[model samples]
Target chain A: MNSSGVRSVARIVARDDGRGGTALPVLESDGPLALRRTRGSGAEARVMLVGAMSGPLGGDHFTVRARVEEGARLSVGSAAATIALPGQAKGEARYDVRLDVADHAELHWTPEQLISAKGSDLHVTTRVDLAPASRLLLREEQVLGRAGEEPGRLTSRLTVRVAERVVLDQELACGPGAPGGWDGPAVLAGHRTVGQLVVVRPEFGADPVTARVLGEGASVVPLAGPAALVTAVAPDALRLRRLLDEALTSLL
Target chain B: MSRAALLVLADGRFPAGGHAHSGGAEAAVKAGRISGAASLADFCRGRLHTAGLVAAGLAAAAALGTDPVALDRAADARTPSPALRLAARKLGRQLLRAARATWPSAELDALGREFPKGAHQPVVLGLAARAAGLGPVDAAYCAAYENVSGPATATVRLLSLDPFDATAVLARLAPEVDRVVDRAVEAARQAVDGGVDALPAASAPLLEIGAEAHAAWPVRLFAS
Candidate 1:
């Protein structure tokens, strides 16, 4: 990656604080990625990502890694959307995220939208691995382009595993150069905003979630394992978020 | 190896229970997106490259004799829709049943017993091709063709589309299906040596979303 672009990494490690609270003993940020510990309630640690600079530009590489050990709880979010912009170098940008949750641990990952601006190309991969008996609530949302603008190219993949078994894995390619009909009625259907909510609980294995359509373009379906995935596509980001939130309200 | 067996396996009327599923066309029709042949072509092209490509890769890999258990996990990884997964397994169970009766391979018998509820349809399709003395390309061809044919044929019923026009839609997609099969076969070859992770994870979100909506319909012409 003769990246005339930036290469950054952000990391967090949460552990049991031993006084009935969660502790983040390691918080690291580099280059364009910044992390800060936020105030939280009992047993859960909170962290917010603050973009330090612009241009997760084409030709850049960035990674975010988070780990929660047994008995620890962590919730991570972003201050605002992360916009991918074109860079001087003519290369696609790469964003990789790795998350691990141990047995009896919990994590809520609700990052803000990722926008792919015109002339930009970004490939993003996110993998979340959970131990048996782990609990997780992950919300992932992507907005193809800013309002009133044609998107460049964006490909995103999310893979989740429970107890080393794949629970949900999917990839979405949108914007220009993806493939014919990607924006057509069979895929995005002219919708620029898409999102998914994955909730994994131990009890769900025995009780199980009832599969149903949540709204106009949304549905919650139970996975083969102890998890339920809610997916939605909307005209814009706000509607996408609303649909996912509504599903979440009834789910959790 | 056996082109005749490949045709037999790829036949749309193979008693695999696929006639009941629209492969998302029923939902697209209900949504007014697939009112005619042109729109159906658009829907099928999208499905062929994304979900179609991924399924072809899995099918080819399984035909190459990849471990079925691991490939099943890989299929689960590629499919996020629970409704689609359920439908694939149901179709797989039906396909395996037909394969055992037709080819009678010991391998097919073992796979059937292993996944009694069903495996993913693509995985079962590949195993069936292998049982019939077919190769990876044949398996990939069957998988890719089925992906488009299911939706194409279903539209003929849902929209009362002209059967000739519907068949022409598929005829036009034959070139793209060839390209997709090449890509799928290449990926499967790589996956055979590297890992199941090497398989294509192309996804069609609306297909997943549509499958869910179709499953919930009180009265529908297709099962998915």
Candidate 2:
């Protein structure tokens, strides 16, 4: 038997509806969930993940789907980093996030970091489908382990499709024995936390508004255009968090 | 050592692993964005304008006997993506190895020892051209051709495009390639005539993003 707990929350902010911006109550669902919204105004709404329980204290799986209809402008962000505590049995968390932007619609999905405690495993997949004239700014941040703790073994995949065409496909697998793995100079560069941000705006010109967030111990690179990809890494989780926040602020 | 010798050095099949790299073409092809010969031609043309043009200009400057170390640094600054930089060095090392074997000039040998991690491909290609007794224009043209064709050919292989069609694409792009090379050669000549400090900086952002994304993939067919 599959005894699982599920929580679903959706919020929509319509700019011209003229309520000075009203917030929706957080909705909860005990099973698989979906949220869809259509708005006429250029408003933004964020969903915070708080008090959601899963399988064991550590091992778990969750599916999340969100869509923004045509002519709607939506922005989504998480309250804080979602933690996957070390599992008794190797555990995994899967997120299949899909965003659909219609003609001239704009969507920005910038979620908080994903922190995997030592010995935990996780996989997160995000698929963005954009129309011909649609625009999207999507960002994801992942930190392997807590400071002073062994970095968790994890695999993360991000696949982006535009106009029904696959544009960006990325997969990262990091552990102790993998060849040229996380510790290699090519990736992570021995850093514990890494963040990636992608912006796709076909309407924008070659040189869009993209900036790098550089801190004492971390670095952020921003790419601009019809599509842009950024990767940043820091020594620890805290520094990674700070760098990501700064990057999003500048990028958005 | 003549212009023909420089052309030989710039040949796509110089055994420098250039054949194995599509210079981001493989990634673009796998993404299904680049489908046919026409699109491939368009992609190559864009690459020529961006990555190819920049590398060619830099190589031309290096051919003027500019400081290899400074040229290497400038190339690195122009290439913001670690993956692309690493790819350039890998190709550079292979090219350097070939150059050492074919033409063991003291300068080329010295560069190998000095830049063990690999100097940028254009910088090394320029040095090799000079050591081979090729002029600045020849060196610049060779650099442009190699950078453009490396990816064009890679796309052909990755997408299984017809070789005849692919060559036809290359033939169509020949004029544009020549135009870019001519511009690069002129700039290189001006730099040499004036001073090596006139070399332009590298600045192509979209390619850099693709390089970084390609680097992070768990499994990839191309080296970079």
Candidate 3:
């Protein structure tokens, strides 16, 4: 057990090959970060992140960066949910994902839920930079603990910028050291799972979305920019995903 | 740095449009999550730390002389609910009007011109505190206290809860508010040196969700 922890960077750069196909110019992986170019169709490129090792244990720093050049369509996903575990190190684990979509490009960042195990502390930051004409569909889900267990400290920050202007920036902290009432009736309301879906389409710039509540635990609303944000919380991941997927259908 | 100025800015009767908003309490009330004074305290405590802390950060940053425009954007970032965003800006606009009349400052005038429709309320509150010759902590204290106090006042009208009990809920949460303010001021100071990224973004999911549901309601006591 290397209590020292690991630092990893897995990256993907997708571009239009100028031959009616998308090309991954760069696919790099280091340490526990593994990247694979799955089968793609037409002008789209897909990447699957395979965790070669179990971690982002405490004191580990992991980064995933994806850039979609103009005219390219990129879809990124993970094989399984990431489980944050406590290590001998003294600090929290860090996982950062940076995404950039150029004009007329598209990106789908549909990562699996991050399960925060007991005694584990992890901070996940996802920053997305998009062009006005760029299309993006990102789904983020957090499952507090495995099941029938209490969650450790987990903080997740999502910041998205469209056309160089911030569209949405928010952070949700749960578990230890978090402010009170997180699990109260007004926040999670005792829900152990929370998730959000961010949809940004060029058409939304002119034809905006009217805010509406989808369910008791979910709502769809517009952001400051040409984007729609859907937030939901449920008793479990299955229900959370079901709500998010329903919202996705309407959004798409 | 006159102590009374903090009172004036944080006053619920300041005509800044805060009274109309329940800080998501209306939705919580309808949800039956808050039935009495004890539940009311629980609700306010949640808000005081999440939204309250974020507001205090923005207010403290603004009072520290950070750009109001940037702070406004930060506020937009921190607020995910569109209804909540609109409410904050509306309150900000009203607060700006009141602050300009109370204490005129070139910074406030510039901010007014920048966000003619209004900025975020906490940003405006911070700038208003600065105009009143107060510091970042004072602004943070005002924002943090107001976050919980507004809902406390609103609950009295919504549930017909004993006015004494409502006041006591706020009184009991004073220490928590102070703790939130300390963290907020610390974040504000960090923001001054490290940028808005350093500001605390602690958020209550239910509050944001409840605000959205509340906005859709046709008949409601609070505007937000």
Candidate 4:
């Protein structure tokens, strides 16, 4: 089913609740954050952030900003993959995630995979600004199609800026007539799902053993003593999720 | 060709832009993971076994005019880290630019078109070797030499090691390079005989981590 023209945004704050469950921090936006429930209910949760909504959108001309204040530990989860339906004109999704963590503040921004349906094109930019002693564990996963189906042709680009420097830049173009691309044993290993996790911690070890353990199908590369890049590839979206979760658990 | 040409092409000072990279050594060093030459040598050997061997095998196949896209994909799949992929592409582009100007041919041009902006180094070098009339053994040797010498030279520059001592280290690595090349040539031959898909897959997780860490550094000189 084609779900188009649906747009909404929701912001959630994470605070230590003195108990195990996190408390929602106070949001300081000029307007209220947008939230909407789809007319039909299914096993999956589909959320869209559009213009006039509180969050980011695919077609907005201006950049959207998200602020995470100090001592706030926010965990943002998506109901499911957000699809970029074909736009009448070229469309783009831009997000500037400004995370202002106080000393020992933790943030986990794990969203669902971004699915670009057939004929859909999108460009997404996510920036994370972290303060010293702030910790962040973020994951970006993308699936080209739905279950039991070959992914439709699409073009998607993701650029992540951490502390004002480009840490991750990826562009995928897959269509019926696109030029030479990822159809080989070495590139994807015939895997359809891929995920990247970036962890910024001050206590990480300098040895290759820790990095090795963190990397499975992914490459574990060190970026100083406090940062690391972990990547993985799997046959499906679920496998990718499981692998990343395991890797992160092992790291902790 | 003279052995000097082999030395020149494989030399750390060839200006192919390899010396600038530690082949993931900088990250390892920054992480305090590698402290001495022996540990550094061990890191180099691991890289040789994983990235080096796979790349050399792919280069040999590309030299025989295999699809550049396929070879590039194979290399990319093996390289899971985006940092390493970018590094390989940067080095590949520079190497191809120089090789095309120095030695131009139809096959090289074809491979260049297939690669366009983001070909990996091993694939380009393999194609360049074929264009330059070099055989599989020579191509494999060049691949192994570039892999080891890049890091050795980087270690010298990063640590300020004596040039004479660096040369001696390179000298010591020559036999290892030959051994790797021999194994790679055999693998290439077997893959060609058995089919490309029949080629083996190997990996060294530690190097992958080093590459990832290097990419995340706030300030770093090396690309990978």
- Give the best candidate by DockQ: 3
Ranking by TM-score: 1, 3, 4, 2
Q: How far is candidate 2 from the true structure (C-alpha RMSD, Å)?
A: 18.6
Q: Rank the models by lDDT, top first.
A: 1, 3, 2, 4
Residues B41-120, model 4: lDDT tens digits: 65566566556777777787777666777667667655656567788898888888877886788876776677777598
**Which digits, one per residue and each the tens of the lDDT, describe model 1 over residues B1-224?**
76788878988889899999999998999888899988999999999989899999999999999999899989987777778888899999999999989999988888988898999999999999999999999999999999999999999998889999999999999999999999999999999899888888988778888888888778987888
C-alpha RMSD over true interface residues, model 2: 14.3
State the DockQ of every prediction: 0.73, 0.03, 0.75, 0.05
Task: Rate residue A84 of model 4 by lDDT.
Answer: 48
Candidate 2 local lDDT, residue A95: 54
Better of 2 and 3 by lDDT: 3
lDDT of 2 by residue, B1-224 (tens): 56568657867667777876777777567645468887677667666655666688778877778778767755654564657777899989998999878778988988989899899999888888887887677777887777667776777778888888888877887877787777777766676666433454322333454565666668887887
Writing each residue's lDDT as its tens digit, candidate 3 over A88-207 gives 987899999999999989999998999999999999999999998999999999999999989989999999999888888888988877778788776887899999999999888888
Q: What's the ranking of the predictions by DockQ, best on top?
A: 3, 1, 4, 2
TM-score result, candidate 2: 0.49
What is model 1's C-alpha RMSD?
Answer: 1.5
> Mind giving the per-residue lDDT tens digits that candidate 1 earns over A130-184?
9988999999898888999999799998889999988877888888888677887
* Predicted candidate 2 versus true structure: per-residue lDDT over A49-103, tens digit per residue: 4433432123455555555555556666654567665455433545556566766
Candidate 3 per-residue lDDT, tens place, B1-224, comes to 79998888877788777888888889999988888998888898888888999999999999999988888888888887989999999999999999999999999999998999989999999999999999999999999988888888999999999999999999998889889889988988888879887898887878888888998888989997
Best by TM-score: 1
Residue pairs with backbone atoms closer than 3 Å in model 2 (clashes): none
Candidate 3's error at A120, in angstroms?
0.8
DockQ pick, better of 1 and 4? 1
Candidate 2, residue A25: Cα displacement in angstroms equals: 51
